[model samples]
Target: MGIGDAQVSAEDLETVTQQLGRTPRGTRAIASRCPSGHPNVVQTDPRLPDGTPFPTLYYLTCPKLNSLVSTLESGGLMKEQTERLATDEELAAAYLRAHESYLAERDAIESLGTQVTAGGMPGRVKCLHVHVAHALAKGPGVNPMGDEALALLKAQELWPAGDCAETAAG
Candidate 1:
């Protein structure tokens, strides 16, 4: 879509409504879409309609992808990443870059006043869902931990490769 078309579309809103099972709050645009043309990642406003601070910039909406990431989280992937972050200086440095990038993206719209990025970035690893969403939205090489989690999911065949998006009629 072009810059003008970047604004949320009716189709995108409907798809996100279905993906979230409720009207999404603070949704600005569809950040990424599934193979079936359904919204998987969304770009949300820094603040909600009620003027509440919403730090999660990119939200993951696809149920299939959410389930896969949840499985990875339950399997101790987050703990593994946390451990890796403590031991691997290069990886930690890369994660710091990811944190900076996330802050830059969010502050471009509105400053959140703290370098603390979503999904426990910079010094720690938490919430694979958020990390995965960031990776999916920003693409690979942006978040090393997220990229690693996605790679693990793909190796386990848990990543969504086919179109599993739910249709309106379904």
Candidate 2:
């Protein structure tokens, strides 16, 4: 469809074309309006051009709504894009990976020192610090890796230190 057609709304054409294209690569091109006038998008997947499987449905603001959606999609793509939420299995797997890594590092540090205190091994501590910082820095958005990292950090009580904590806090 062309950009301009009084009978066809740009939003409708965009939605239908996206369904046919089977690619939701870009942000939603439509917005939703509630009874109270709250704008949002109700994502629905009709089918692909070849009738293949599609991703889950989700509502989002239109990219035309001041380019917010486009900005988010672009930023996410640049930063190893992630969804807003994680499944339980994903969360569990991330937690297990982080926990295993932390344990292995802790063991290595303990081996280096005859007596291991809370601050005995600065190397392992530093690693933990970095890991936690990385997780938290992923933003307040819901994510499996971030959640797992945060959980591991809290379990170990390896609070942030020095510039890392300052950066995370800021």
Question: What do the candidate models score in CA lDDT, each in turn?
Answer: 0.83, 0.33
**Please, what are the lDDT tens digits per residue for candidate 1 over residues 28-62?**
87787776667788888999999999989989999
Model 2 lDDT per residue over 9-79, tens place: 45555554453444343222232322222222333232234554323122332223213223333445213
Q: Model 1, stretches more than 4 Å misplaced?
A: 1-5, 162-170
Report how far off residue 61 is in candidate 2 (Å). 5.6
**Candidate 1 Cα deviation (angstroms), residue 118:** 0.6
**Residue range with the least summed lDDT across 10 consecutive positions in model 2:** 117-126
